[model samples]
Target: MIPAGRTPATVERAAEIFGKSFNYFQNQRLWEKLFPATIKAFHRAGAQRIVRLWDEEQLLALAAQRELPFDQQDIPVLPVADPQHPKPAEYQDEDLLDVVEAWEALHEAGSKITQRAWNTYVSRADDARETSAPAPDLEINGSRFWYRKTLLDWDKTRMGRGESPNAGRKKGSKDTTGPRIRPTAIARLAAAEGLLRALPNLPQAEMVKAIATTQNVTDRQALRILHEARANLGLPAPSPTEKK
Candidate 1:
């Protein structure tokens, strides 16, 4: 008998308790034959791997019948649900908002996002969808829509992080006057600095070009930042005619 509220176990764990290799279970297709109902596949959050879970009590029963050397205390319990996994919220047709409606909703929710800015974000989200990135909750008849809860949740998270609820500006936009740089650019800047240090012999011009290409900055701006970075590292500036 299956225990109530029993957590599922991974097939790998089940195979171990049954004193059988995973290949043995797969080759014989024992899961299909003996416990088809107990088999389930779950996709972990933000991962491509599919985890196969099984009913633990059923596996233990079969193991006991076969006299497999298994201890009930040693069985590993896999969590039934991932806390980070996104759950689809219950929503109705009235809760869905088209781009214009979503923009208005954002404004009403104190987002301070202009319609023009909102449209830019929508375009970016559409482009991102092509690469399997996050996008609107729904698209139909050439219109994109998001659930009210989804938009609100996104705004809440942004506000919680002390960032503006408005979506990020376009790449290379002339808006560097902000006090804080975007987190991703900061990370990439750090990486570029590390590369600079590791390859000190590399020409500053070449390094500047690389940083400009990666960070979407102009060569002049890249050169300025590179000079500051080198100075911080106690390295001398390369002359304009320096070929090394």
Candidate 2:
């Protein structure tokens, strides 16, 4: 039931914004959230309210015995809303659980960047003449290294290069086999996934190096993203030496 002077629209808006919110498909956490939700509201910018019904006689009796401020008449029975465009109050970004998921995704991506920088690099396809070559296969003969890294501009390149290899779901998906990297390409790697350049572990370093080499840039963007992510996670920042 809405307040005496309030209109139906106001009640509808409240229900839309908060009723479903109260029923977010969470597990046992939903019950745990009530306390934190109340606290969050208290710390929030607005003077918020937390409304609930005390149907259990035991609790109601305790509250009544203690002369609680609550009144059953104050608990409004909110009506559900139409599903088109949700009301503004129903905006979930303000909710903490939403924040948790966003943080988790970012953190997971960042760690993957740290541990498998090359895989991260490979995930992003080449930009120019888009080349989707698999990580290069190196034949190391003493000092004379051998691999190929020349790239075809993706725009000029076509999928199903009769001899080229492919991965991922689409024909234009990632290159699991294409060109090998030459000695010169090493200097150019790190454009996309940043520098797994000289990473001690050869497989990852080599894969990312191939991607960066094909990408043809010196920007350490991926490494920077990972490093910053570490900082955000409360880990120490990785310096140039450490990243290298």
Tens digits of lDDT, candidate 2, 1-244 = 1111212222223223334342352323333432211111111122133222211222223323434343321232222131122343542322211112222323333422122432343346545122333332221111111111111121123343332333233345476586554333333322322433234333433444455456553346434443443444454544455445
TM-score of structure candidate 1:
0.42
* Candidate 1 lowest-lDDT run of ten: 82-91
What value of lDDT does candidate 2 attain over all alpha carbons?
0.30
User: What CA root-mean-square deviation does each model show from the true structure?
Assistant: 13.9, 21.4
Q: Could you give me the TM-score of model 2 versus the true structure?
A: 0.17
Off by over 4 Å in 1: 1-95, 108-120, 123-134, 140-142, 164-189, 213-218
Top of the candidates by lDDT: 1
lDDT of 2 at 124: 61
The lDDT of each candidate is 0.56, 0.30
